[model samples]
Target: MPNTVASKRVHVAVGVIYNPHGQILIARRHDDAHQGGLWEFPGGKVESGETVCNALARELHEELGIVVHTSSCTQLLEIRHDYTDKVVLLDVWKVLEFDGEARGKEGQPLRWIKPKTLTKYAFPAANTAIIDAILKPRDSSFSSH
Candidate 1:
């Protein structure tokens, strides 16, 4: 039989986790990882045995040294982008609450930036949509965080 199964696309979950101060947490990719040195949200790829929410929680812990309850995060947006080696599908989340300080435990620099001011920083092209989403006004159901 000819090979008929399609290759599984690489998907990543990113969290636009922010605090009440209107500062969004962004992290620089480690020098060895893909798109290293570029500023992006704090998250990682979903592992084989974990759900997206679980992955997000784990990533936040690993990257930021913060423990976030999965229930506290909500899906904010999803994006797909094609790169030279692989296609990436990014599921972005908005984390309303978590525990512990967000340190760059992975040796990447972390910054808390105001959404309106994000455009001034250099980010991956795909991040433009994420920024736009952040800048849009929230609705009645929106939480301040």
Candidate 2:
């Protein structure tokens, strides 16, 4: 019988972390993993029953040695992108308050670049929407959720 099952989408919690200098944090994916060798915001998948905020906090700490301030976290955007092999549902968040100096805990290279220069770096196709959102003008305040 011909297959009719739909592919499951990977739900990822992405963080657009801003430093005190207004720079955004990005990390390079391992060359062997999916979307390898491209720069991406530091984040990872959301486990079942995990809130987006919880997932973001977990991923950022695990991947980038930083603790996200959940109260300062805000949903920036949600994107659903389909690739040739996999679909992804990206839950993007703006993380203004965090603790510790950000580093790549997974041994990947990390970059803190001005948002205006985000276009210069090569990122996954799914990240295009995130780049656009970051460039758009908006109120950047640290209000509690």
Candidate 3:
């Protein structure tokens, strides 16, 4: 049978939203959905003709009820991953400032966790890079001996 899933590369915008307390926000993917039951940074697919940062700001507002200034977004990293069904290019950003409280606007479970404790939760394979990127600075501050 022909592959039902589209082979097109998907562009996604992910936000590692941070609060004043040094905690980052995460959300649980729907259990029955793709990469289900995994904790992921909140984001969505970037529609055609949309800039990556614009998409990030749009998704954040639509999914979390927050208005983010695209100009304030810090481009952090980009990850490309190919899953069995499709391929995705994840454009990750660090969002430290925004207006409004973040809630599960989509009814998904959301929580805040310290970056150093991210390993305690289960995440999709693509997220490993993000986790490492988030920890690199902290990792350097610790004594290696």
Which is the leading candidate under TM-score?
2
Candidates arranged by TM-score, highest first: 2, 3, 1
Ten residues in sequence with the least summed lDDT for candidate 3: 136-145
The residue ranges of model 3 lying beyond 4 angstroms of the native Cα positions read 1-7, 138-145
By lDDT rank, best first, the candidates go 2, 3, 1
TM-scores across all candidates? 0.85, 0.89, 0.87
Q: Tens digits of per-residue lDDT for model 1 on 75-138? A: 8788988766567899988888889999998788988988888888878899988888888845
Q: Least lDDT summed over 10 consecutive residues: which range in candidate 1?
A: 1-10
True-structure RMSD, every candidate: 3.2, 2.6, 4.8
Residues 32-73 of candidate 3 have per-residue lDDT tens digits of: 988799999999999999998899989999999998866667
TM-score of 2: 0.89
Least well predicted 10-residue stretch by lDDT in candidate 2: 136-145
Clashing pairs in 1: none
